[model samples]
Target: MLIDILTQRCNAQRLMIAEAYQSMYGRDLIGDLKEKLSDHFKDVMVGLMYSPPSYDAHELWHAMKGAGTEENCLIDILASRTNAEIFQMQEAYCLQYGSNLQEDIYSETSGHFRDTLMNLVQNIYKGKPVLILQGIREEGYTDPAMAAQDAMVLWEACQRKTGEHKTMLQMILCNKSYQQLWLVFQEFQNISGQDIVDAINECYDGYFQELLVAIVLCVRDKPAYFAYRLYSAIHDFGFHNKTVIRILIARSEIDLMNIRKRYKERYGKSLFHDIKNFASGHYEKALLAICAGDAEDY
Candidate 1:
């Protein structure tokens, strides 16, 4: 019943349910579920209780909390989200934690990688919503000249003096629309004869390059990139339950079907199959439920 309710309801509906549950019982749904349930099942249920932005902000806090940072969590969220989404997540972060998300990120991270994340998340701080939110999708205007120019700038960053590389790359990646960025990536390949991901791998190391690679992969094919992330999360012969739960829940409404298709294409097996093989019990059942309605194996 829990699985059915969470899996069947839209996020808004689920939030209503959580609210109703709280009002009726005088207890928080997530808190009760945490007390009753254990392990990943609790995680899935609790995650379902929050709205998407709250959940994202929650993930971000956890990513930056404690002894060390989970750089992948930061990269996965900040790199892939649209500017509008980031803005909402930032607001939610502030509301939930009573601290500025950007400041926390700045204090937690350092150097070029920190700078890149700040750039990606800077739109909200500027007191204006980005163009993407104001219906850029229906128009999606891509300028080839601009793309080529941006491509040259990126090439210079890779080939030229070391000091300016991060600025050049993050400026374009953080600001461009996905359509324009795609064109820029094509121009980059034409000028450099190397994939941008490959170039980043060559030119930078540590989390700086990792963030760039994630952005490039996300720009080119988000579902494919997510599929790879899902694979990477579980295929290490160890259960990365946090990453798997995060991706499955976060992308459930957004693009799970497309991600499922890409996963099969890339791995020669269904995501359902992989989950069954790699995870078990109600934890697996919860994942499979969000992933329900389509599990046809290739």
Candidate 2:
């Protein structure tokens, strides 16, 4: 039914069905949406459905007040979506709601978390190999193969069980290109039957360890890993503050609820509860709104 509504060319038809479904059923049409769609079209529909009510100060204020903030939902919707859709959503969000989506997200989120999410939303390919090449060039290493080899070794350590090796891998993972890192990830997975994340958990410990593992897993199979990270950061890690902030802020616009469900299943805790406990300030509030899983944007 949700897909049927979304696939309609007429805006009135889509909105009418969506509003009617919400009114009569006393349930969000979005919750019913996942089962109705798949792939890029799902991405488009979900983004449109999960857009915040307004990107203006009033919406932010309401978000701050914990009434319909929809930050996590926005993040998941945006993150899983393609750059083109995000760009379109941003345009529509501003035109219809009278607010800039990027500015609003910037207002609601901060730090490296904000940076990473924004980078994604902007469709900045920071993860591309050219960025890695640039970094290598800055290091006075002209040979791509040499740089590639070093990157692979770091990735290898991230996969292997050696403490020193893992540490080295973590540094590279944190600093290197998502593009380069992604290649390295593919290489590592191919070389080892075990996933890199599994290797990280087996060999490393602590917040950094978890963060590194999260990044690895997110890069590997984003929806699945993010689902798990959202759960752990909120429920078990004492909100670990940073981790919750990092994952939520980074992925809120990306594929978080999928992460949320995975978190719920694996941890047996509500994703919202963890956010309520660990998150504080505007940031926390925004994330909580996101996890509630409303699909208003599409």
Query: Could you tell me how far off, in angstroms, the CA of residue 97 lies in candidate 2 after the best superposition?
Result: 2.2
- Cα deviation of 39 in candidate 2 (Å)? 31
C-alpha lDDT of residue 203 in model 1? 82
lDDT of 1: 0.85
Off by over 4 Å in 2: 1-79, 123-181, 186-216, 229-298
Where is model 1 more than 4 Å wrong at Cα? 124-141, 293-295
Give the total clashing residue pairs for model 2: 27
Lowest lDDT sum, 10 consecutive residues, model 2, at: 132-141
Predicted candidate 2 versus true structure: per-residue lDDT over 176-200, tens digit per residue = 5455566666556666666666766
Q: Over the stretch 1-298, how does candidate 1's per-residue lDDT look in tens digits?
A: 8888887898999989888988998988888888999888899988887888999999999999867999999999988887668878988999999989989999999998999898887754246555444311212668999999999999999886376766888878877788898999999999989988888898888998899899889988999999999999989738788898999889998998999999989899898888899878888888888888562551
lDDT of each: 0.85, 0.52
Question: Which prediction has the highest TM-score against the true structure?
Answer: 1
What TM-score would every model get versus the actual structure? 0.93, 0.38
